[model samples]
Target: MAIVRFVLCLMVEILVLPVTILQYVGIWDSLYKRVFPHLMCRMTTTINDKMGKVKKELFDKLPEFASSSGLTILEVGCGSGANFQFYPWDCKVICTDPNPNFQRLLESSGAKNEHVKLEKFLVASGEDLSPVASASVDAVVCTLVLCTAENVDAVLKEILRVLKPGGAFFFIEHVAADKMTWLHFIQHVIQPAWRYFGDGCYLTRDTRASLEKANFSQLNVKNIVAPLTSLIKYQIVGYAVK
Candidate 1:
């Protein structure tokens, strides 16, 4: 029995679980449309762990980025509005995604901000966000959201275009598999299937270089090498001042 349970956990950890692991960890808008299997709602019913809360712990490390209030903010690739609760209350947040069902679910979740319902839940792509004005947004937060966005460069350009001159861009992304032998091997082997079923999420991408090349300067980056969570180990969590 113990061995069976261990095997079950291993299976879940191998990137195929009842729940789309990308949705739970990546929290990107496109996961529902691109990555998730039908009947994936069954997994959400069992999720007790809060990825957003765990992610919020790294926020205090970003005192400068947190000081803004009432600034217009955009959470590009906002998936299911899970990261919505972690952002500051005063800043107006606009969450965009391509999935209408997830958008309606987010709407029905009654996800509200202090000032208003997080404004403008739109059916949009990150590469081309037309509704938002350039140089008008004060901050952009991308949390584990880069891997699946159709064109990362276009999205980065959009981020640069929208951000105000001293605005902050905070992100927590799951990058490519690290140099570790076992994980890298698995990641390489699963890359094809992951692309097909995991919503175009690559197990490999230098997430930091994307931010750096966009003319944004990195503020902090932590490489978490914790066990059992090695798949997300190559993490880059920090804010860049534009």
Candidate 2:
């Protein structure tokens, strides 16, 4: 057991430490921004295949919650526009992400998903959505984003600020596994390296707790296990009204 543990630690150092070092020196950000969109695009098929039903159920409720003739949605952290196809036809989408490199990929996705109109892609973080007007959008969508947000509370506030009265905020995010479980232990063990490789994504964020405290007018969230890696399988899928 001692020898096995030593070997595993050595492997982690050899494989993961260099990337962590690059991140520390700020070289990783430039390289990751260019590479991540393509990687996400490649992985979209598998991800959707596993989580499509939940996403459909979440997005299908847009008309029910929205009180607009032409739905205008603001999608935060709209990486590679993975959710573009899921949106209702003719809905106008405003996309935002911290990484500017995703703009090209988002446009490409918009071309493919021409059913939904792509209004524009803004390079902005979720915590500061000053580019969007207050109470403007019919709905706000955030998928797989809260775990990586620098300030989840600030992002929630911004989401609330931009959404129209009675407009809904839809989210599908990975969250921390139950405490004291083997998966939770593994998540902690690999979190340092995961954050470096995944561009600030936290392996053990209590995002549900943050949402519950955000004081949304109506909040309905539930836990589900996604067909993803064990480290990020435990997830929450639901919407909150503001």
Candidate 3:
């Protein structure tokens, strides 16, 4: 069944590849942001609420594994700057996203200025990050991001590279459903259409496997269900020291 789903996903990606390439390069940032986030919000809110709860747990749990004191933190795909308020007073958090409008919003929030030169802001993608320094960050945070990434493994290696030895990576992500037979079937069947609108989100990816395969030690994952679908599965909140 897993092989069948992977094959189906690959077929859809092949079909969508050309248009996706064009959209990635030709779509203007302003236009993309206007349509993209609004379209996704309505479809994604229920899962996002679950995401928020898991992120809150990470904020509280991070101090134990990746303390804020003298730490440099990085947030990938930081939409709306939602995680900013939860950060500790002493940490320097670098918020990054490829979306230009969202980057501008983060800049205007004064998260950049108030932290002075300490805080870094950049327009970067998870799979290809340029602003982050190797082995320099104390913690890397990603929430509900992998579903949209074109290459999840590359991003994980990037996360590992940027994290200092003994530093931790914190995350909360939605994964493939293990409980909802009907909804899962629908998700699998309509994935091609979903890919077009979702900008590449694959609900079928076993996010836990991807994370663990990245060599993140001490793997711990738990299933979590949101308001609508079991495919909104798992809220994973364990740290792997680099």
Predicted model with the maximum lDDT: 2
Best by TM-score: 2
What's each prediction's TM-score? Answer: 0.73, 0.92, 0.76
lDDT of each: 0.64, 0.89, 0.69
Candidates 2 and 3 compared: the better one by lDDT is 2
TM-score of the candidate numbered 2? Answer: 0.92
Give per-residue CA lDDT, model 1, range 1-242, as digits (tens): 44754564466456554345554575543555643533333433222143444467754333344334556778787666655555554556777776656666566443453433477787788899888889878778787678878788898888888888877777778877655666766666566556655556787777777776776754556665422255655667667777
Cα lDDT tens digits, model 2, 153-229, are 99999999999998999999999999868777667666767787777899889999999999699998999999898
Q: Which stretches of candidate 2 lie over 4 Å from their true place?
A: 1-17
Say what the RMSD of model 2 is: 3.0
| lDDT (Cα) of model 1 | 0.64
Q: Which stretches of candidate 3 lie over 4 Å from their true place?
A: 1-30, 37-52, 65-69, 108-118, 228-235
